[model samples]
Target: MSFAEQARPIERRTLYDELVERVRGLVVEGALQPGEKIPERELCERFGVSRTPLREALKVLASDGLVQLTPNRGATVARLTVEDLEDVFPVMGALEALAGELACHNITDEQIAEIQDVHRKMVACYEARMLPEYFQLNQRIHELILEAAGNRTLSAQYSSLAQRIRRARFMANASDARWKQAVSEHEEIISALESRNGEALASILKLHLNNKFHSVRKWLISQENGTRKG
Candidate 1:
């Protein structure tokens, strides 16, 4: 079959999903920074799609807490505060800890191996000074861990929450020093899991998330100081 003949026609449903993911990635990667307004016409041209699909994608992103749509001012990347983390992280920690405990009983050897592979790749990215790529792998590792937990509803909820949280973290740090410690922390998590130490894994993961909250707190203070000076 010729390439074009074999290629399936782009489905409207698939187009919307891809558009949402692409636009969400822009915000998550800081390509569209928080509080930055999106130029709709520009985006339509850039994506080579119509305004209808683009608008649909924007609506999805807004629903995901990545963008805020104003009555008249169109859409902009959502600005997150440290207070946001204060409200969200604890619940997320509890859920993830719950997931880890369940995962201990549900995980298969193949899943464990996949997790290990992601960790190894993350370590390599860290060594290569590729913070962005490293963090992406880090996310995959956590997701794999959650999948191993085998709780469908909890996994879906966590993924939604995490999408919002990841956008904030990416905006705040982009490439911060604490990323190094984060890599080492994942090492501990993998080690604990390998030993089937569920309790220890839960504790470590909780502490890891708590530390993130602390870091966000410190960053907020710094931002406040900068604002006062300016």
Candidate 2:
């Protein structure tokens, strides 16, 4: 290898970053369920890490609103209450609308084509009943729009909120009707971008996020009630 190539920074990930990602995966995949106490010793054993890094990772997760850490009770996965969802969705909707508006003004033909490719792939995933893959691609489509918007501040804020609410993707698995409805929304989103209709895209994006919030909130309420009854 050339000296110049070897000298370049490769963006190394710290042990804490790795641990945080692993724990996040556990929660998102339902291995660490909401409101369930995180077994610190068991997680350390599974990941082959020490207590220090595990605790550090948990702290990060808590800040992201994924894990709730208490003084005496330790950490449990956070339950998404109706109030929390209501609080977040409006912020997300407004950011998404702004992104859509700016994306239409700034997006290049190549960028649009790239997003379209992901859109097609996402549709295929939906057709195959691959919820996880579809969810990831759907997120990628939104990410590309945010990136194309070319506003660093908007992108950063939108992305931080996006990460905090990433688990809401799982709620789409609750019903085929809602899943299909979301796919339909994505269809309009792609069309809006294609036509460079900024206002149309902004409105569509806001409505889509609103619908998603409602769907997830409904499912969470049902689960909460079921737990109460049992």
Candidate 3:
């Protein structure tokens, strides 16, 4: 009721959000690796804030399962296992499938045109041998599909999940061949969407995700085997 009280609550919320973004960005950018401890003084100085806001942000990240907080050791980045991937990726695939189905139902002509343009740009990136550029376009196309799904909650949830897997999702595979395969998969997904076939689009999306999962798994296994042999 009082202006002071009202202003305090708003300020608290804003600081909380700012801190959350700071910590999340560090994790996403790999400035903080999984299971690595966050330096308290460094964060305090970098953010130009006090311990209160920094701790609040870490708590929020811990709540998101993005970090683990201990009594004495403080917070460390969350480490994901292959089993974690098995649990998380399928849920992501289902959410994507749901988005694709909804996109088919609610997509506007203008949105379709935008996605088409992105697809064309994506192909151009592939042809130019600019895989990083192509991957960015690929990400934009998927985000567009989720936005066109017209469900705010779904979009937010999917985005959060994607953020959790950002590192693994962006890791390079064995060769450029994998990049080419990814481009081909994106083309099929766009074609299915353009034709307004929800079922086909969903299937393509699932396969696209599975391919990434398999590729990552193979790479991880090879690394482990190499360590064993060494």
Q: What's the true lDDT of residue 170 in model 1?
A: 50
Off by over 4 Å in 3: 1-13, 223-230
TM-score of 3: 0.87
Question: Model 2: per-residue lDDT, tens digit, 1-230?
Answer: 99899999998987789998899889877777778999999989988889899999999989888899999889999877778878888999999999999999999999999999999999999999998899889989999999999999999788767766677646646688888989999999999999999999999999999988878888778877878732
Backbone clash pairs for candidate 3 read: none
Task: Determine the C-alpha RMSD for candidate 3 after optimal superposition of all C-alphas.
Answer: 5.1
Candidate structures ordered by TM-score, highest first: 3, 2, 1
After TM-score superposition, the amount by which residue 171's alpha carbon in candidate 2 deviates from its true location, in angstroms, is 2.7
Q: Write the per-residue lDDT of candidate 1 for residues 10-67, one digit (tens) a residue.
A: 6566677899989988987778867789989999999998889888999988887789
lDDT of 1: 0.82
Q: Which has the higher TM-score value, candidate number 1 or candidate number 2?
A: 2
Alpha-carbon runs more than 4 Å astray in model 2: 1-6
Candidates' lDDT values, in order?
A: 0.82, 0.88, 0.84
Clashes of 1: 0
- Checking candidate 2 for backbone clashes, the offending pairs are none
